[model samples]
Target: MLASQFSSRHPSTVALDTGLSLMRVAAPIIAILLVQDLFSREFDRKLHLTSLTYPRPRYQFLLGRITAIATLLLFLLIILASLLAVLTTWISYGYTQATPPDLGLPYVITVVFIALDLLVVLAIGTFIAVTSTTPSFVLIGTIGFTLVARSYSGIVALLTRDSTLVGNADTYQSSLSLLGYLLPDLAALDVRMISLYGDWQFLPDDWPLRVVSTLAYAAALFALSVWALNRKKFS
Candidate 1:
């Protein structure tokens, strides 16, 4: 169900395009190099040259290889994010929008939140992949969840704006307003807005609420996902 939206698109998983320029460009090259040299050399040199490998043993080796790659990926994400943050700071130094790296405790919080988000996503993908016995299901589900979240955010923001949402002081209007306030409003934490905009375009005041909200929501989602995975029994 989660992946339905992703599969709906023809040629689904052409994810050959999404990501930061440096990562999007460098990742595949790096992966190929690593796999060809390290993975292939280790496995092929050991198995084909060393001995015959069985399916179970092959999966074990592949799983170990994936763990190493995932670790590398985590570090890659950290470095990439740190580089972007540094570059943004360097470019925007002395500008009005320049907030210190420690500004309002958002950096650490965001990093932790994003890490947790990544774990939840990977967990969801792994669980679904294992249970469904189809890699596409996991791929599509993760992509679909992201797409659905984006769509839901857009509609909620459009409907809750002052003109449409808080139009009148009627009871129903107040309730609608309160509901908007309570629902997980994600548009607030859009970090891209800060990175793309010129310095001084926005203040901490403009985005702090979003950071807090996203962190809170991320925690809840992660907890729920973990609980679900723990309870799920695969046949």
Candidate 2:
């Protein structure tokens, strides 16, 4: 429907971009809900007590829950990506844009990056779920983290372009730069232009490093969650 309504000649590109943009927003919410159900709700209802009674160690339970949620998320991503690909292909039929989208490798890579982004969010939510006593904090913290991580780079870039537009722009930029170390700049993971324009130049020079850093960050969070769960004493 979005493809048919797109005013641009490249309705296929617009359609895929719009669909992906929607997925970017929706995926985090879905991941947070899964984390809440698998981890937060278990703690909230004291269901973990029964599950922990199993001979398996606490880390095993934590690992298994995270794995289950991640698998479900991956499956959903694959289905959505396939549907979007079909829609884009259908829209592109007959009409040819000056710059056709790759729709093949580039599209697959874009989807994989999105999956990584969701994994990072899931890991953060899982960590918050295990450490925070209040189950609600898991949702709040995860959403807050997502908002900050996704937008901070853009905010800093805007400030950098015109310091005179905002008073004390240096202060804001400096603060954001410092905070950047702790938060993954998820916006950087969005290499959709590579797929949208069918241009490898759209891929960032540091994209491989960014991917590694994202994976490392998620792994570290998962490890912390496991540690937190092991140390948590239930009353």
Candidate 3:
């Protein structure tokens, strides 16, 4: 399928490409669908009041739920990586008589990026769930925001290019600068090229910055969701 498109002469590339293929198509969708009802269901069924009456603070409860989801996803990702490892070995044998492929630090870092991306999506989904009154609205908002966040940079790039051709680059470039600061550039975190080329030069060297930015963005969303939940009245 889509994974075959990323297949390369290198076993490492095959493993990484397969993993990215799965993540590209499935990660955000799975993360959103999993967390879309996190808080909305509570509001819909009138369970938020009961949950708020617990001994712990509100943020702690939210953190617990988020942590639980993250842990579950971690387990699933581990299984996925392990399967890819086995597949890489099989592919390696077919391509070369070398020993089982040894995935290097790059693959490890790529896995971290994939996990972080999922967490970012989860945080956005949680925020939508917390703010929305109905599960349907939560699902819609989460999907909408995910699509916007993922493509915002590309959309701005297109606008800036068009504006330049029209001799009005300043207007669009300024707006694009403002938007670049406001929205998380999820594209910056894409390391699929590294997996495809099996080399560091294939991807941006400053990828760590992207990972840090995403972490900060996810933290902000979690804080906002907690704040919103605290301000809300269960009645």
Tens-digit lDDT string for candidate 3 (1-235): 3343354445555565666667655767766666755566767888777878889889997888888878878888878877776666555664652222336666667777778878788888898888876788766787776676777687667766576564566776676667677778776666756545556775676777887889999999999999998897766
Whose TM-score is greatest here?
Answer: 2
TM-score of each predicted structure versus truth: 0.43, 0.97, 0.81
Give the poorly placed runs of model 2, Cα more than 4 Å off: none
Ranked by TM-score, the better of candidates 1 and 3 is 3
| Residue 136 in candidate 1, Cα distance off native in Å | 2.2
| Candidate 3 deviant stretches above 4 angstroms | 1-18, 96-102, 155-177
Q: Residues 78-190, candidate 1, lDDT per residue (tens digit)? A: 78666655554443343333222332234444444344444334433433433343434455665554444434556545555644454453554445445444444433333
Query: Could you tell me how far off, in angstroms, the CA of residue 173 lies in candidate 2 after the best superposition?
Result: 0.5
Error of 2 at 58 (Å): 0.4
Screening candidate 1 with a backbone cut-off below 3 angstroms (N, C-alpha, C), the clashing residue pairs are 3-141, 97-200
RMSD of each: 12.8, 1.1, 3.6
- Identify the superior model by lDDT, candidate 1 or candidate 3: 3
The lDDT ranking, best first, is 2, 3, 1
Model 3 scores what on Cα lDDT?
0.72
Query: What does candidate 3 score on TM?
Result: 0.81
Evaluated with lDDT, which candidate comes out highest? 2
Clashing pairs in model 2, backbone N/Cα/C closer than 3 A: none
Encode model 2's per-residue lDDT on 121-221: one tens digit a residue: 99999999999988789899999999999999989999989898778999979998886899999999999999999999999999989999999999999
